[model samples]
Target chain A: MSRATILSAILSNQPQTTQLPEDLQFDCPAKAAVTEKFIQMINLIGGRVVEIQRIEDINLYATAHYGAGERLITPIEELDFYTQFAGDEDPHQFENIAFAVFKTHFAVAENGAVWITEDRMGARVLPFICQHLGMLVFEDSIVSNMHEAYQLIGSQDYGFGTFIAGPSKTADIEQSLVLGAHGARSIIIFLLKKEL
Target chain B: MSSIKHPELSDIFNKDEERVNWHDDTLWWIRAKRDKAAHGISEWELLRETASQIKNNVLSNLHNYLIEFEEKAQKNGIKVHWAANAEEHNKIVLSLLQGKGINQMVKSKSMLTEECHLNEYLESNGIDVIDSDLGERIVQLAKEPPSHIVLPCIHKKKEEIGQLFHEHLGTEAGISDPQVLTETARIHLRKTFLTRRSALTGVNFAVAETGEFVVCTNEGNADMGAHLADIHIACMGIEKLIPKKKHLSVFLRLLTRSATGQPITTYSSHFKKPRKGQEMHIVLVDNGRSVQLGREDFRNSLKCIRCGACMNTCPVYRRSGGHSYHNAIAGPIGAILAPNLDMKEYADLPFASTLCGSCTNVCPVKIDIHDQLYKWRQVIVKEGYTSSAKTVAMKVMDFTLSSPTRFKLAGKIGRWTLKHAPFTVNNRLNLWFKNREMPEAPEESFSEWYKRNNSI
Candidate 1:
């Protein structure tokens, strides 16, 4: 088979193996300012950030903005929805989703991306198929950069995962900015405030 | 310059002065955005170094990593296929689709598939494949190859794309707004995604430590296509593998920043195990990578992450346009890589660069792109792959420069001819005069001026 031939050829020609670089060390300051950076970056990438105190505030924001009959879906039990997703269902049935919200494990400050896995998303397609997407992250669950984000995700097991940064966007046509491409037309980050 | 019918393809692209200038300015703006993004990260240079070292380790132990990757991916219930070349890769995809009795598929942006010409191959085999990326879809509608890797239809103007969408997707005439055009595509491709039974995507990184593969996209097209389809096929080159999943931190931070200057693409989804009742297949394609690996001097090119930074920052590429390179991937990186695939056909590519070193400076993994471009030139000339006219010109340049008397006399004659008979050097035979007018003969030779000034 071609596999053996290709492997042997690579072994013959490849340079002697070199060691991977040591674990990266960040000497930069601003590690404590991750929350500020996350808010700034998310806004820059066209995602709106709403600071709220209670879990119920998400519904307040959604109800104020969305019409009554819109198909708004969320995993948050406090919020109203037509049905609960059992995490195992046909993805095709989720089409025409006006808005979908889910809780994230943590968020990255450097890129405004929130880490969400299949457990949080009933289906892998829910985050991307909706017209609008809302990701709720705990105020304290923010990391400075990807290095720390990976450290938090160390040795974790999941079927699927992603870091959703911004709403789907494209500059393909003449470098023109279009907010919604195929994914969510808009992304709103509902940053929950800590209660005393 | 390589063909009898077309004078250098770049020259043809240059005929439209307005388009050429617009293309140059647009890419340079993207390069500026890259600079700003890279500066935001304090550890930018260190990250580049770390990525480079990791890739060096990957290349040296690629054979081991490939097998480890195969074992893990198969254990995850993902079928792994090995393709020796482009033909076999295409055949594997066709059989997979045919076995399922599916005739249509949706694909995301995978430069590997572009390198393999998968769409054309699939179409020939009676399968319909729609490219879901907006830029790719535009060029696909035009039935033309993508000019830029990251921005497939960068060479096109808004009016032209509006025209394509109007003809193909039934948009109203004279709709030149990019927003309108993009929304039209979103609605059209959404249907294709919902209805298609098969989806094929290109792998960005295949982790050896785990069975997972990551597909990054800004449009979320890959997720839409793969998640909805019954059968999912992901193709990757042998060189796309890394030893562990942790290394992704270094690459993910560098990838989008260097490309389009976004902190990260909108979606960086990791696919490990297939969903229940769904099929996931990965084709580990060699397709001349082994040969490129055996080439000791050029093997480092296999570490490319397919980011378009080099093209955006390349001076020659920006002005001359991507079609000038005449390959699936265009830009400085492609120049070095194209020659590895076919020395005879791509010998002209290495000569396309100005050796500006801008491409190397912006390269995320710190590929010595200019040096590789220079090295490929030497190999091409030594292998006798250069054009006969160029060979003779180089020989003449050598013969004249080696002797001072001949050099001085030749300089005198060149000045005399330029001053007395401009037509001789201003004709089509003069390649330099093709794209630009010959500079007026210098008032006097530098040496002559030096000699006169030295006496004072």
Candidate 2:
């Protein structure tokens, strides 16, 4: 077949196998539980959590959220805020945020790690931005190694994907272990109950 | 015009032994970063191998893949252009801008543009181009090419950058802090980003399966420029394609770790389809790459992901500096690749290295950069492309080294002369003695010492 036809056939078949998971549904009790879970998850990932009654109210953690309050929300805004904030304050804050919230299909509970598809986050930046990142995962999605993670995702979709383990940890300066030089400092996994 | 050699800068390498040491340390620092990031994942080496194989497949099937990418891109309302050479690439890009009647453009970091000198070409044709990436902008303001690929203006000190920002961006004249300087560039480029009608970017990888191109940058400049511009142009060489999306996982794993030691770039953007009312174009430039592909021994050089891991790990590139290579690209990888584009013009570049294998060792995709440099030296010598002085020296050495008696006699006389007359052998005028002290001759030569010690 012609390359165009082959590509179209590939792309047309893509959505069939790889639909974005359906909008998550939650009961009132489940919602309350998830909220608490999210706060606990954030704390687990090294972010100090402050509760706000409404989403509009700025939890100092939320108001000071890197990309949250921007007029023109280009992907660049989030990236700019993180780059400057990382260099100025704790560099790992942005990375920790990126690790926490950006959607992930897989999580490794053993190490409190997250495996993100490239589609949910832009190629590399999503994993590096955000001070405290929250990863939403179905309980059954946990994997032992990246090899199994790759097999489960298959080979068709996602422009680029990465398996990020924990936050930006480094031993670069004089072999002194420095956690989070440029990427996430901590990764929090929120394992959701699997749907029937 | 006579090869544009930088003999003056060569003195820096010759004078300070410390230059080599600093170079080694800087590269090793980057190398250490790579190790730290790679060790985080258990399958890191396997991923590197997979990425390498995928790229190899792309290169072997490049001609077909380009045709495939062009057809799909065209169907998606994206214009695809082919340039057989650098001059052709420049002409194609200029004509595209001219066709749109756009005279101003904001560009993200595209090394292909650097290779084609796109900004200079566009300026000559009266199109003003602004580099949006802070590192690129700094190098552009300094009127110098990028010294390093990922960190373009890495050679510039913070004070120099502060001064540049002060002059151009109206920052406080005395402030020399990096954070302040970077913020100034950020504010300045924001205005350029909003105003420019067109944007151009370089492709990190182009997936054939999606007809999408990926760009990774620390700053989100590429995404900002593409999102705001009416027209988006992405320039890439034919060698950038990989077979599938899952393969990207492998490359993404290796690229950032090898480049900046980050787990991932701050922004890795995938432009699958143009936004509403935006025109997307992909320009594939050959620029002697096809000829490079034809050479069996040197073809693997094309497999470079341009992570610059090789440059960061190369002892020669760090000491000699990027400008010494005299090309848009530099370092050990550049030394081998530059000669393919212009052998006689870049004859000195390949010989500039010490043939250390650190570049090969640190390369994520495992490009045999040092070996390629060695092969290029052979090609240059065989083609009679070297300087007359070098040619004469090589021939004289070759004649002496071939004869055992002559070699032994020359060594004995050299030791006798050095021991008898210290000043004659050691002087500032001698290039080898400029930085390194000639060791004081012992009472006897190594051969004499060995012979006497063993005999006793």
Candidate 3:
């Protein structure tokens, strides 16, 4: 079998094994200002952040920011203005969604990315097919760097998960940045101060 | 029956001086962005070292990790396939598509697939593959291969791209705006993403601990295609496997910053298992990687994460363009890796470099790219893959330099020729004079002047 042949080949040619580094810990002096750094990074990456005192404020924020003509879909029950989408549907059905407001497990401060899984998204394509994406992340759930983020997500089970830092963009044409190549054009993160 | 080498191909690329300058400046700008992003983190060097050590551990015990990954992925309800070569990989994909009765598929940027020539193989088998990445799609429309790994169409100007879109995508002529052209591609590819039953992506890193793989993209086209499709197929080289999921932190931190100077790619999507009612398949392809692993000097080349940092920092790559390397993966990394696959075919690639060591310094995993380039040149020459002229030239150089008298005589003759008949050394016939002017010859040699002036 090719598997056996390939495996044997690799094993035969193996170099002396070196034990993995003992300490994976990295100390970042900027940990105290993770939130401030997170916001700065988000702005630089073309993502917007709105601080809300309560999760219920998302409804008013959605209406005030997106207006009535926009089609809103969310898994969060607190946002009454947005329609709660069914978990089961053809991915293509959500192609024209104007806004997708979903809850992220946690947010990484170093890169301004929120971790979301397929279960939270209802449909896998909801986050990408939508014209805009709005993520609800608790302020306390933010980690300082990717290392902390991974530590928090140790051995977690999920079919699909992603660390979405910003909206879809490209610089393919003469290296000029263009937003909304094939995914959401704009991503707005709503930071909820209260616990879920 | 014709085989052209790197020099001949680069000559063609250098025909347009303006394009060459634009390509060089654009890549250098990206390199500068990488510098800024790398500088943002205080422990960037520490992070690179940690990542390099982690890769070393993985490489030493790769067979174990691959097995563990395959076992865990299979247990997670994700199908795992192993291919000895590109042909087997392509056949596995074809059978999967055929079983599902799918005629077309959408593929994100996968240099592995490109190396396998999967698109052409599938097309020959009557399967239509649509490239979804904006840069990749631009090259696909132009009916050409990607020049750079990260920026596939970096060799193309906006006007040329506009013309390509105008001809292939039916956009208005003379429309060179990136926004309009990108939007046109977005609308055009959305239909393909929605309709295609299967999506193929290149795996950036596969974790053995959690049985998951990650695909990073700035445009989010990989997510759009994979999430929307019913089946997702990820192909990776055997060297892409990491020991654990936590290793991702170091690799991801270093990946985008080194590639395009971004803090991180826009989307770093992880696939642990198949989505509900959908199928996910991971193919581990050897395709001469095992042979590369057996070679000690070149095994470090497998540590590359396909970030294209070396290509951006490469002076030759920037000036001659990525296509000049004439391989699926080009630039400094490609030059070393290509010769391992085919010595005779890519013998010229190793010599294409100037050994400035910039590529090695910029490498995220510290591949020792320039050192490997030097080694490959020796290997190629030893294997008799070099041209006869170069071999003869080396022999004459050795005969003259090995003897003191012959060296002194040769130096005298060379200086005399340069001083007396300057035109003999400063003409088109002289390869060195092609792009440079001959230096002035002094009346006396430095050694001669030193001997005459010394009283002791």
Candidate 4:
């Protein structure tokens, strides 16, 4: 009758599987090249990219901004950088930019999409909070559907994850399709080369 | 305990039948949009069938799956609570807020909350609950219940909303522009979103496998409120659960298309875990669902996704207006479901529909709404709850029809009386004839004509 007792009964009946795919492998060497290609793709989509270095953290960073006619960037290394840009601190700081491109574990070249799990963004809110969000996908991890992609990251723990297709869009207002409403204005897929 | 029902609203509608025509046309336009969006996908029907079956399986195994969902949600640092009824659900939420020492909260549109009158209850307890959705906010300010679930202020014109905003929000008077009025509300609600320490939203779908709840919205208000708040409470009916994530793909594909004819809602935020400094709670409310679920004829009503497609496509709903049902939910779907909550109290609702069957056709989950309404009528009538006048009339008709001699004599008398006294039969005393003209008495009854034409 207790909730725990019922849950145990349900889980006991479930079939559990833990098998890894042969082709599903992470390539750590492509990280830098993927970052560059991501920047190029953002530029190609009419976004401005700015590179900055932090002396205290000893890390390089870049931020891309696109919305209206303004292009602003926040360094990737800084904490709460996106929030500051998104005007969490000030209510008047609403920007007309599309999305922010971030480096991710891997990219699926098959669909020209990027993989950003909840772990990298710290929260699922980040990807949706921006107007347009772009993720750097390494050439190796792209697959046809979610089923194949899940098999690659076998047994890896994550809080949450999602496969975003494109820019935030809706046709609900008046049946006229508007690409951007609250979240990312547009999503640009950056397909990085094999070598950095 | 009988309050005088507002006969004037019904009277006004009766006088201006054109308003019903306009209302029907508006809802039909949205129905057409749904059809267009649904037909574009090749696997649309298959997806609906799968979603329906998945929900059916979950309902059949609900006791087990609910336990699974609660356990996984608790493991993810989300607290879960159960309420046997609406009062209990509101009490649990208030208790949670009292424990947090919070007094103010912002809420996204939740029909479950509306059914429970949670805002009025919370305010009675001295807590300020602000409605963040534009449509809900309009109706909230008016101190009136929402006429439609999806479009809460659908019955009101922009001019009325402009006046309300100007009076309450200090906007320039005489400005009826939607864009300007909407922007004003957006800015006003943005302040509430930032200051409110707690937020409440409705659960569209809860995946039993992952222990996650999905809340869909157009303005992203639900997400904004939840993400910014210290405490996020999601109120869901017990029937919202689905068995797996793959099942969500099927539902998500059909829900928006059926509800508003959109490819997808603007925001479909999945809440799985409580963020770093926030707390999450889910209250599963079962006010009258368990009792309804036990009824074999009406249990399928539980499968409804609250898409409002049924209402949009329902001809009777558009003409009668939602307020006619006098329940938290309205329209054809509401007619069937409301009676199950309180058969005597909501008896009029079930008889409100014309049994056209358009609602079932447009239903994304296929609930057989009109059939259920018809069934409720029979149940109500059998319970001796029919009005005294109607009961007497039915008895007289039964007596006359059961005897051929009595029927023939009654028919001849009726014709003679009608022909002699037209004004008496076609007066205001007969409310049915108020808007209709009575046909002149035939020269002879149909049976009399038949007897003369052929051997009887």
Candidate 5:
């Protein structure tokens, strides 16, 4: 009844149908330096980028920066040092995970964000609840802007997806930037060097 | 009982002159950041224009789009609920929680819930709702409402927040660093996110084409709460809808750049359907929005994305503080939107601005905010909601300005009072004389000078 009443009220009140605008692609501001701009933005937003030639390098990077006692989990099979994700645990079970390395569908250059879905995340909370996060982004997969990112993701179905640009942060206290507020404190982008 | 209006409330906020200056400078710093971020994109202006047109079209055919969104979202296995008003919205949420036998809940930053007074309502109803956003949690601990939409406790100093954390969150005293405060909150709320069965988040933009809604946040608290909860409740005003998913390209580019000068929020999470065995409920809340849609002059206010750019760019909001507006939203956008809900209660809000058009300039969707503000003044006055003194003042001005002889006489009297009886015009009763010095009274009127010069 509420739905019917609300719709009737809206129908009686809303203006006549107006046409949607034609889609137009805007040029990227940083035209040729997509990778450079990606790194710059990633650093500016308090995220780190570590260039790697192969997926095996992530294990070395992880082992050097992290220790064996910590729970370093990943969905990427190439990273042998990190434990493989089971993908079917209670979201609460992953709360103690110190590090999570997952693969992103692609990366957006302008904003330095990686597009990921629940499938890549292993669990919905894996990307958010971990103390530190590492998202693997292929160099060629870096699109210039949001338009390209959306074009790539046109009608692709996923239950949950996100564009993670940086680590969790807030500026609530007098505009001072504070990191690790109820989510991942640090996000390191593993930029894979591949042509395609 | 009648509450304090905008002028008096702002006067209270302005009493601490140093704090007022700090607030002004802080918000201006954010506005500057926004300018820098907007300048980074070559297509920034074009992007804003495209986003505005999309919103215009969405407003024009909102009913159909809402239906489309609901149908698609339901097909995606999300339960859709409709509420005609705030009370109904709250009730639906309560019933959902009750149905699950969940006593504790977690909510992210939702101004709609703030407008509905959901926290207190739920508290009295025995449902403990914890706000998981860092800023929101700070204000929640202080027993205060959020000051700004995006930055909830911008009015609070670090020392004050540290004190609040000390008292409520069991932090060490005098811990004023933002890093420590934020970490303490993360530890405190991590348990809440893990334990709470119901999670409610604000909807940033809901795509009718894909039946998925986006929640943008820098802290990622919304995802933490929703991903872990059994029942994910998203509260959305009907105006948050866009026609298609691709339109997000234009808006996502503009949203955070306008708010805090970021390329985008750290996490722009899209929730389309619930995870296996989890319940997802989207409440399409009217809550005076349909009435706002019918108002031609004020309908564009509904197009706001709650980025708080207008607030950051608002001179009145910066100097007077966001709490002064006494609405769920504060600042220029709030001034125009509040009166539509209760004109009599918010009659003074439209008059809070200087009609500087700065809010309109920075608005990502170009809502004609200053113009709508000016229009609301006329509507409020016509509805007899303005103060009686202002009404009388308008009547006298009308009588004097409508005729030449009367205008001339009134000018003569005004000049005489200013020149001879200066106290009559330079006192507390005249609001114009408060922060400004009245100009020196001339010996003769401009018309008098012209008549004598006669050479023209």
Candidate 6:
């Protein structure tokens, strides 16, 4: 069988294993100013960021930006929503969601990415299927770089999680940057200063 | 000089000088972007070094990690399969789909599948496969292999893509706007993602510690397909494994920065387990990787992250185009790798380089690409894989160079013939003269000129 042959080949062919490097530390740019760097990175990645003093301000902004007719959905109990889905909710039902407002566990300032796990999202498809996405990240829950970001989530277990930096994009056609290729067209991260 | 694959194919690609220049300039622009991103990070070199070391460790302990990854992944409700070769890999995928009675599948960009020719294999076995990545879909519709790994259709022009889309996706004729065309592909692929019961993705990094895999994409197609589909299959090369989850930080940081100057891909999705009711399968394909591992000099190539940085910075790759390499993977990495798969078939690939070392510098994992290309040439020639005529010519040149009198006489005769009858050396039969002009022959050879000047 290929398995036995492949494993034996790998075992026999491998040279002496070397020790991994000790405690690799990186001096990321966001170490000094997390929010400032996060804003700069988010803009660089073609995503907008809004600083909201109050958590409730997001609903008003979403409604004002998307208007009242758009199908806005949020799993956060405190915020306003048009649809609330259960744990066992079908992801296909949210195919027409216009706005998906979800809470991100943490934000990486170096890349402007917000960590969204399956538990944070009511339906896994909501954030991706929605026309626009609003990622709610706490002001203090930001790391300097990927090193710190991975450090925080290394031990955590989840079925699925993604560090979404911006809305879906592609430069496949002659290297022309095109936004909204297959996922949310616009991504706006709201930095909530309130306690969860 | 010899009947090599890359040179023959590149000769055809070089026919369109304008397109070749455009392709070169386009990839160079990306290379510049990578430089900008790399300079932005203070610890860029450190990150590269750490990633390279981690990969070295993984390679030296690959068997243990694979076993560990399989055990943990199985515990996480993911079925793991091992395939020795491409045919076995394709058959395993086919059987999985057949077992589930799945007739159609939506797949994201998985170069492993491309390496295995999985799409063609499945199609021949009566299964329909749809490529969801915009670039992959463009090449798929054109019935062409991906020229570039990251940018599948980079060799194609916007107008050509417009025509392809107009015929396949019903886009309006002569509409070359990327924004409009991308939306059209999005709509077309969205329907496929929703309808297809099974989805396949290529694994970017498989963590042995946690038994999770990461798939990075700017379009989020992998996540969209996997999340929506009932079944998800992740095909990964044995070299994709990392020692631990913590190692991902160094790799993830280097991957997008070196690729397209992006801080991170739009979606860096981590799949640790199957979703609530979804069935996930992981296919680990050796498929010549073990043979490559056996090669001491070329084994460092297994550290590649497939970021395409090497290709972007490669002057020959940019001008000759990816298809010229004629491997599923192309460019500097492919040139070193293709020979391991079949030395005789890819004998000319290593010679397709200028050995400028730009690819070696740009590689995220620090693979000594140019050095390997140089080494592979020696290995290929030593194996007597070159044309017999070239071998005889090389032998004659070697014989003349071994003696001072013969070398001087040969040089004197060569310059004399070139000066007296330029057509004798600058004819169609001479490969060097085919695309170049012979330098003006001096009155005296360089050594003779040096001796005369010193005596004065």
Reference-based TM-score, model 2: 0.76
Model 2 residue B305 lDDT score: 91
**Which model scores highest in lDDT?**
5
Flag regions of model 3 displaced more than 4 Å: A28-32, A67-69, A81-86, A194-196, B1-4
lDDT of 6 by residue, B102-132 (tens): 9999999999999889999999999999999
Which is better, 1 or 4, measured by TM-score?
Answer: 1
Calculate the i-RMS of every candidate, to one decimal place. Answer: 1.0, 11.7, 1.0, 7.6, 0.9, 1.0
Candidate 5, residue B314: Cα displacement in angstroms equals 1.2
Is candidate 3 or 5 superior in DockQ?
Answer: 5
- Please, what is the TM-score per model? 0.96, 0.76, 0.98, 0.79, 0.98, 0.97
Candidate 4 residue B235 C-alpha distance from true site, Å: 0.7
Checking candidate 6 for backbone clashes, the offending pairs are none
Candidate 1 local lDDT, residue A68: 80
Instruction: Using DockQ, give the best candidate's number.
Output: 5
Residue B278 Cα positional deviation in candidate 3, in Å, after optimal superposition: 0.9
Candidate 1 lDDT over B1-456, as tens digits, reads 352111378778988999989999999999999999999887899999999999999998998999899999999899999988898899999999999999999999988898898899999989999999999999999989999999999999999999999999999999999999999999999999999999999999999999789999999999999999999999999999988888899999999999999999999999998887799999999999988988878888888999999999888899888888888989999999998888888888888888989998999898899999999989989999888887899999999999999999999999999999999999988878876988888878898899999997
TM-score for candidate 3: 0.98
Clashes of 4: 14
lDDT of 2 by residue, B1-456 (tens): 443264555655446666556555766787787887778766666666666666666666666566677766676677777777778788878888898899999998888999999999999999999997777888898889988787787666567777877888899888776545655665577568667888999999887765777887655677657766778999998778876655665676688788867656544566666654678888877777777776867878888999988887776676667777788888888888889999988888887778878888778887777889899989988998887867888898999899988887777877777788878879876667865888765566677689999995
Per-residue lDDT for B1-456 in model 3, tens only? 113477788889999999899999999999999999999888899888888889999889998999999999998899999899999999999999999999899999999999999999999999999999999998998899999999999999999999999999999999999999999999999988988989999999999987899999988899998988888999999999999888899998999999999889999999998877789999999999889988999999989999999999999999999888989999999999998888888889999999999999989998899999999989988988888878988999999999988988888888899889999989987889978889877777777889889957
Off by over 4 Å in 6: A27-32, A194-196
Worst 10 residues of 1 chain A by lDDT: A25-34
> Each prediction's Cα RMSD?
2.0, 9.7, 1.7, 8.0, 1.6, 1.7
List the global CA lDDT of all models.
Answer: 0.90, 0.65, 0.90, 0.68, 0.91, 0.90
Per-residue CA lDDT of model 3 for A88-186, tens digit only, reads 577888877888899999988888889998879878888999999899988778888899889988888898899999899999898999999898999
- What does DockQ come to for candidate 2? 0.07
**B352 Cα displacement, candidate 6 (Å):** 0.9
State the fraction of real interface contacts model 5 keeps: 0.89
TM-score of chain B of each: 0.96, 0.94, 0.98, 0.95, 0.98, 0.98
